[model samples]
Structures are given as C-alpha cells and as structure tokens.
Target chain A: MYSFTKPKKKQFFKEDTKLWLVFYAISVFLYVSFALFLLVKAYFYSKNNQIYNQNIITLNTKISSLTLQKENIKLQKTIYEDIMVKNSLIKDSIKNLLDLIPDPITLNKFLLKKDSLIIYGITPTKDVYNLLMLPPLESIFTKTDTTFYQMPNGWYKFKSINKLKGNNETAFN
Target chain B: MKLPSIKIKLPKLKIYGIDVIKNALFFAFYISMTLFIIAFIIAPSVKIFKNAKNSYFLSKQEFDNTKQNYRHILEQLTKLQNQNQQILNAFKRNFNENNFKLFAKDYMNIIKITKQKTIPYKNQFAKTSYIITAQIKSPKNFYDFINNIKNYKNIIRVYFPIDFEKSNKEINLTFKIETYRLLTAKAEEKAH
Candidate 1:
C-alpha cells in the first residue's frame, strides 16, 4: 500500500527587534529629561513672579506719595494768590478816592472807618461848601452830612461825614 | 543507468555568550549618550533660557511703571506752573505806588479847575495809609476840593478835618486827608 505525506513550510522570526529595543530606551530617556527640565523652569518662573510683584508694590507706593505732594503744593499756591489779589483790589480803591479830592481845600482832620469818611476843615465861603455836594463826590457816597459854623475870625469851620458806596462797600464787606 | 539522488543536511547555528554581552554593552552606551545630552546640554540650556525670559519680562514691566510715574509728575508740574502764572498776572493788574501818585496829581488838577489856591503842607506815609495836609485860600475852595476827591478809586475810607481862620476878605482853610494803600511786604515786616 502507498502512503501520501504533506509538505512542511519554514518559519521566520521578525526583523530589527534589537533596533526597536534601542529606540524605545532612547525615547524613555528623552521623556524623563524633558519632564525634569519643565519642573525646573516652573520653579524659576514662580520666583521671578514674586520678585516682580514686590517691585510693583514699591513703585505704586512711591507714585501715591508724589501725588499727595503735588496736591499740597497746589493748595498752598492758591492761598498765596488769593491773598495777593485781595490786597491789590483794596489798594486800588484807596487810590481812586485820593484822585477825587479837588484843590484849594485844606483838610484839618481826615478819618476813614470801614465804609465811612469823615472830614473836618475850613471853607472860605458858602459857595465852596455847596460844591462839595456835586458830581464825583455825590457818586462816591451814598449819604453825606455837613456841619458848618462861622467863627469870629470870619472863617467857616466845617465837618463832613460821608458814607462810602459801591466798590468800597462791597470790598470791605 | 539512473543514479540514486542523495539528501544533504546543514549544521545548526548557535548564539554565543560573548555576543549577548556585546549587545548589552552597546545598549548601555546608547543610553549614557542620551542622558549626557539631556542633563548637561539641553536641560541646562533650557533652564538658562527660561531664566532670561523671566528677567526680560520683569524689567519690561518695571520700565513701564517708571514711565507712567514720570508722566504723572510732569502733569502735576505743569498744573503748578499754570497756577503760578495766573497769580503773577493778578498781581500785575492790582495796586502800585505809581498809580497812587498819579491819582493825587489828578486831584490837584481838579482843584486848579475850581479856581482855588491850595498850598500842600505835609505828606506823611505810613505802612497801610497816607496822610496829606493842605492849606486853602477859602472855605468854598476847600468844599470843592472835597467834592472832587469823593469818587477817587482805591479809597477804602477817607478822613478829613476842617479848620478855618478868618482873614480880611479871605478865609484860610487847613485840612488833613487820609487814604489807604494795599498792604505791602515792607508794611508786613514793620508790623511784625
């Protein structure tokens, strides 16, 4: 009797197994190194952030102090200027009154109190006394009262009280 | 004649111990080279770069803050200067001695217009006030003089005392006039 036999095929192992192992080892090494590097970088970043925060705080304080100083300076300057302006106005008012006095009048006593003016002097004639009641003088005072007496020496003694008006009243008030 | 074919058999190959050790040593060398590059070169370089970046940002922020502060100070300075200028202008528009003298001269002119003769006797200046005494020919001339001076500017108040002497056909009048000026530095010093 003849017997039939089947043919057997040869088996082969995968190629480059050693090379793959080396590649895996190198990859693991690189990964660990990168992770450590990241950790170190994070630490440095945190330290730097803290330093910067401190610097900013210091700068802010300095700026606030400077602002306060500026405000103080402004206030002082304003006060000084106000005083000077008021003084000037008062001086001008005085000059205005002095300009209005007419010649040929002799003043014996002159007194200024608040918004009132008092004058005591001698007038040669009644006409000179009448002239005191007109125009520029009239405009300067709100009210005026005059008292005159004829002396034995033929001279007239006069006293006048005038109330200051307008600018003078407002300025003193 | 047909000859019988003979089958040939090959010898089996075997792995040696030295070859295994050699492969292991090669793998170790490769790992060491990778470690050296990562620890000594790449890692340190990365750390240095990170440090440089952090410092750059910090300095940049500081610069910006300083610039802002500088601008704020400059603005304050400008405001102060403007206020000072305004004060100066106000001072210029106000009181001066020259103006006072001019006002007095104008008053004398008004007296001349009234056809009166006045002889100025004494002029006394005080810190805050001025007093002028004059002798007039007649009471009428004195009254006209008073009327003219009433509207003078800058007179906070005025004081005049009238005294008269009788001469034949003529009345002689003497008057004292007081006026004020703005307070000055010299006046303040004297007060102190």
Candidate 2:
C-alpha cells in the first residue's frame, strides 16, 4: 500500500522530498505502537479462555457429586423410617399388656424376674384366694410361676409368675 | 570562466546487507503491525462477543438437562416416600393387634434370660446393617438357656464373643444375632 506513495526525489534537499520523509516517520511510529497493543491483548485473551474452561469443568464435577449425595440420603431415609416403625410396634405392645391387668387384685409389691413375677400383698379372704387359684387364672399366673407369702398380720406377701398374656387377677392370688 | 575549480560535496553513505535487512525488517514490522491490530485487538473482540452468546446458549442447554434430571429424581423420591408410608401403615396395623401382648411376653422371656446370665443388651447398632450381641455370665447357665432357646421355635443365633473373662461363679459368653426380615424386606418387595 505504501508503494503508491513513492516520490520522484533525485535531490534530498528538495522541499517535496522533505515533506514525504516527515510523513514516513509518523506512519512508522503509528504502526509500531499498534503492533505492541495487539501482542499484549492476545496474551491476555488466551489466558482468559483457559480460565473459563477450567471453571466449567469444576462446576460439572460439583453437580455430579451432589447428585450422588441426594441418592444416598434418600436410601438412608427409607432405612431409618423402617426402624422407627418397628420401634413403634414394640411400644404399642407394652401399652396393650398394661391395659389387661384386672381390678381388685390390689398389687402391693411386684417384681419382674426373668419371664415371671413375684408379688407380696393381701386378699380380702381365702375364698377369693381359692377362686384365683383355678387353672384358667393359675394357668395365666403359672404360665411362668406365682408364689405368695403369708404375713402374721393377716396381710399376705404373695409371689406369682405371669406370662404377658395371662389373666391379671392371678397376680392377686 | 566562473566554473573553474568547483567541487560539489556529496553525502557519504555506507552500503551493507545490515542496512538492507534493517529496511526490510522495518517495512515488514509496519505491515504486520496493521494486520495484527485488526486481528488481535479488533477481530478477536468481535469473536469474543460471539463466543459469549454461544456460551449463553450452551449454559441454557445444560441447565435444561440438569432440570430434567432433577425432575426424574423428584419423581423417584416421591414414589419411595409413598411406599414408605404404606409400609408404615401396615406395620402399625400389625402392631396394634391383640396378639402383640403375646409377642411382648415372648420378648420379655428372652430379656429375662439375658438378665439371668447377667448380660446387657446393647441398644446401638454398629453399621448401616443390623447387628446383635449377647453376653452370658455363667457358661453353664448359658449352655442350658441355649438348649432351651433352641427348643423354642423362634429364629435366632448366638455368635462367640471375641473377648470374654471368667472370674469365679460366672463364665461370661458373648454372641451376635441378626434378622433378614427387616433388613432385606424392601429389596424383596421391589423384586416381586
């Protein structure tokens, strides 16, 4: 492009040649300055691209890990919930058994030993004691074993064995 | 007559390949400068803007895929939750039955055996799987109790303890037990 600006200058002292020389100097300076700017910009742009790619890779990794964590948590919840249900069943079983204890069998002292019960108490009369000693009642009490202690004060210290399913009145006998 | 003895002084300049090379280098420097200014500074900025638009489109596509995956996971989680609810309801119904009292009685008998042997039941589990442990103070009593337990119709096991100490009247024995009923029930249900 500069070839179009060539001049017919046989004499360096001529006014026209001097004018062209001045223009050439200015153009050289402008070109050199522009080249330097490009070099600096290109270096920085390449660096920016490298960093951008790295960030995308890091984000992709994090997303995958989070997905795995979510799946593990869901599985854990199911297992934990099943355990809670079994525990509730055990609790309800205890409540139902407590409700079955009969009235009038005033329980004075009760001890739970192994699968049996030992009681120390007074029944109003011996007939009531005899009635309670029957097999249906005794079977309930002796499902494990029941023993009673007779005190001199007419108050008896009684011990009896009870299966959790037995009649509650057997405790009085 | 006036031109006699006149000598014109000329500018003296040296000729070397170095000067030609310098001139060629300067010219090339100028041309490359113009091309690079347009290519690096101006052209790339345009490309950068275009790439920004491309990035936005790519991110949008990725976001859509992630959202779809999230929706699928949510659906699976909801189904699991519903199944869990049904299982819990069934368990509750079973627990509230009249026979629960009998089950407690049986369970208490086992506890009594444990206490008679002076073994404490551990309430905590070791791993994600189920674990059971038993300790007996008297080996003779434990032997007898084990015989009785074997006669009973419940499924159970007694593992030998790794460490046991025997002092005087009691011989301590430790064992482990596990159940497949609660542990693998869900997987079996799914299989069916």
Candidate 2 lDDT, A1-173, residue by residue in tens? 37877787677444533554565678657655655555455545555655556655665565676566455445444544544443333233223333333443444433332244444445654555556543444554545454656668665545554554544432222
Among all windows of 10 consecutive residues in model 1 chain B, the one with the lowest summed lDDT is B109-118
Q: Give the TM-score of candidate 2.
A: 0.31
Per-model fnat list? 0.07, 0.00
- The C-alpha TM-scores of every prediction are 0.41, 0.31
| Position A1, candidate 1: lDDT | 58
Which segments of candidate 1 are over 4 A away from where they belong?
A: A1-46, A108-134, A137-169, B1-63, B71-192
The per-model DockQ list reads 0.07, 0.03
Please provide, for model 1 over B93-117, each residue's C-alpha lDDT reduced to its tens digit, 9 standing for 90 to 100: 3334455445545333222111122
- What TM-score quantifies how close candidate 1 is to the native fold? 0.41
For all candidates, what are the clash counts? 45, 10
lDDT, candidate 2, equals 0.43
